[model samples]
Target: MATPMLTSPLTPRLTRRQLMRSALAGSTAFAVMPRPGAQGLTGPAYEVSAWTGPVSGFALVDTTGKTWRPADLRGRAVLLNFWASWCEPCRAEMPTLQQVADLYGPDKLLVLAINFKEPAARAIQFAKTTGVTMPVLLDVDGRAARQWGVKVFPTTLTIDSRGRPRQRVQGEVDWTSSAADKLITGLIQA
Candidate 1:
C-alpha cells in the first residue's frame, strides 16, 4: 500500500508577531525606494500621470468662512496642494510653495493649499506661522485628500487652464528651483 501523504493546512496563517514584522518590512521597503522625479529634492520620487477629466471636486472653507470650489479656479493654472500642520515635510515645503506663488502672481497662477483633516484654527495657525500668503483651504474631513489620492503630505498637483493635472510632485520639492520654475512656466504656456 502506498504511504498516505500528509497534507498541510489549506490556509496558511501568520502569527501576530510575524504579521507585524512583515508589515514593518514592507513599509521600510517602500520608504527606501528612490523618488525618481524629485529633480533636486531629497525624498521618494513618484511620477505624476496626466490628469484626464475633472477628477473629483471638493469644497473647503477658507479662513473667512467662505466655500471655495475647484470650478472657480478653471481657466487658470493652479497648484493644488494637500498639506497638514503636523507633517514636518509639509511645513518644510511651505516657504518654497509660497515662493512659487509669488513667482507666478495670483492672476496667472492660483496656489491653493488644502489643509488635510485639520481644523480651521490649526490650519490658520499653520499658515500664520509659516507666513504662507496663498489661499489656505480647510479640508476638515479630508474629503479632498482622499479624492486626490494624497497618501503623503506635501503633494502638489499642477492643473492647467482646462482643469487637468499637468504635473504632480510628491514629497518635498524645491519650488523655487529653476527646474521647478521652468516646469510651471511651461504649464502656463501650454
Candidate 2:
C-alpha cells in the first residue's frame, strides 16, 4: 500500500482552487543554481544538485506492455518523470515535457511520464486530452513510486547515458525552456 507520487492515497480529491494555488506557489519556488565549476550552465526550474548516484534495479513498464530497463537505454539519456493527473503542477508541466521528448526523439533520449496509482484509462484519457505525447507508464499500485523514492507530484531525474542520475529536479519544470534544453544537451553529450 505504498502511496502514489504526490497525488497521495488516491482518494479525497482536491478542489480546483487548491490545485491552482499549489501550482502557482510551487512553480515559482525551488530550482538550485549551477555549482561552482559547472560553468555558464543554466536551469531555471531544475535544481543544480549533487548526483543521486546510479539508479539500478528499476524497470518502468510502458502502455504497450514493454518493460524499459536501464540496459535497454544504456546509450541514450533518460528523463524519468514521476507524476499524477490530480496534481496541477504535474499537469502544468506536461506540454514542456512533451516538447523535450519530441525534441530529442527516442534514439537520443527517453522521456518517460510515469503516472502513479491512477487508473490506466484515466491516465490515458488525461494524456489524450492534454496532448501529452510522451510515453505514459502506469504505476497502478504505487510500488514504482515508492521504489524510486519520489514523494513529489512531478519529480524528474536526468540520467546520463550510463544509467546514472545526474540531476534530480524535485518539482515541476518548464522542460521546454532554453536553459532546460542546454542542461539536457550537456547530459546527453557528457
Candidate 3:
C-alpha cells in the first residue's frame, strides 16, 4: 500500500493576540521612513485585468519546508516579493520586509518572500543571518520569477485580497514607511 500525504490547509489560523503583535511590529517599522517608488524595479505595470494568467494561485515551499499558496492568501492583502540571496539590494531591504510582515499581521496581510533561483539552504542561511521572519518561498527554477515579470532583484508586487496586483514597486523600498502601511491597510479593508 502506498503511504498517504496529508495536505495542509491553504490559510493557517492565527489567534487575535498573534495578529495584534504582527500588526504592531509592522506599524513600528513603517514609522521609520517614507515609501519609495517602484521605478527601475520591474519592466512595466502589468494590466490589472491581465492578471488572469497561470500565475494565479501559485504555490512554493517556505524555508521550513512548508507550502505557501496564493489561494491561502485570499482574504488578506499580500506582498509577493521576488528576491535572491546573491542580490545586494535584496539583502539591504530585508529588515523593512520583516517590519512590514510584523505590522500587517499575518491574518490581514501576508508577505511572501519568493527566492529566485536560489538553493533552499542558501535561503535559510540568508534568513538566519538577516533575522528575517517573513515566510521565504523558494523558486528554484525561477519559473515564478519569470512568470511574475520580475526584471530586477527586490521587486515588490502588492496584491489585494482579490488577488489582483495593485502596485508594482521595482527596486529597493523602505517597507516600513507610513505610506506602505496606509496602502496595505487600505487594501486589507478594501
Candidate 4:
C-alpha cells in the first residue's frame, strides 16, 4: 500500500513530503500554470522557461527620451517585458502591468517594457491610448532581446534584487491576478 503524505499549509495541494522532494529535485513551482489554448487566458498558455542566468547589462532610452541602464537597477526586483507594437496580446496586458507597477512601486519593483524594433512615436502613441504609464524602453535593433533569449513576443522576465534572472513567462499573463501578486511579492522580498 502507498503511504499517505502530509500536506503543507503554504499550498494545500502540495504535501510537505512533495515539497521536500521538489526542493531536493530542484523543481520549479508553477502556481496556476495554464495549458496551451487555455480559454480565458489573455493569450496562449505561458511557457514556463526558467532561466537562472544573469541578465546582460544594456542601455536603452524610454519613450520620454531618457536613457536608462540595466546596471543601475541592480538593487531592486525588475520585471522586464519584451513587447512589440503589432502584438495584440502585448497591448492587452499593458494595463495589467501598469496595475502591477502601481501596486509595487518603482522602489520595490521596476516594470520595464522593451519595445521590439518599433519606432518611439508608435510605441508612445499606443501607450498613451492604452493608459499604460510604465516606462517603455526602445529596443531599436533587438540586441537586448537576442542576448536575453527572447524568441517570443510578450515574454516577461523577472530579475531578483541581486540582478539575477529569476522567473520567465512566455506569453501574455494576467499580471494583476492575485496569484501573480503573491508571486511578485515573494520575488521582491526574496
Q: Can you give the TM-score per candidate against the true fold?
A: 0.73, 0.73, 0.69, 0.76
For residues 38-63, could you state the per-residue lDDT of candidate 2 as single tens digits? 44223333344444745777676777
* Whole-model Cα lDDT of every candidate shown, in order: 0.69, 0.72, 0.67, 0.75
Can you write out model 4's per-residue Cα lDDT over 19-84, one digit (the tens) per residue? 443343233455333322333222223545567755656789999988888676878888899999
lDDT for 94 (candidate 4):
82
- Backbone clashes in model 4: 0
Give candidate 3's TM-score: 0.69
Candidate 4 TM-score, C-alpha based: 0.76
Best by lDDT: 4
After TM-score superposition, the amount by which residue 156's alpha carbon in candidate 2 deviates from its true location, in angstroms, is 0.1
lDDT of candidate 1 over 150-185, digit per residue (tens): 666677778876667776566666778766777688
Q: Which stretches of candidate 1 lie over 4 Å from their true place?
A: 1-48, 53-56
Instruction: Give residue 1's error in model 2 in angstroms.
Output: 38
Candidate 3, run of 10 with poorest lDDT? 40-49
| Clash pairs, model 4 backbone | none
How far residue 104's Cα lies from its native spot in candidate 3, in Å, is 1.9
- Ranking of all predicted structures according to TM-score, beginning with the best and ending with the worst: 4, 2, 1, 3
Question: Highest TM-score, which number?
Answer: 4
Model 1: per-residue Cα lDDT at residue 180: 70
Question: Which runs in model 4 stand beyond 4 Å of their true positions?
Answer: 1-44
| Model 2 lDDT, residue 170, Cα | 64
Q: Candidate 2 has what TM-score? A: 0.73
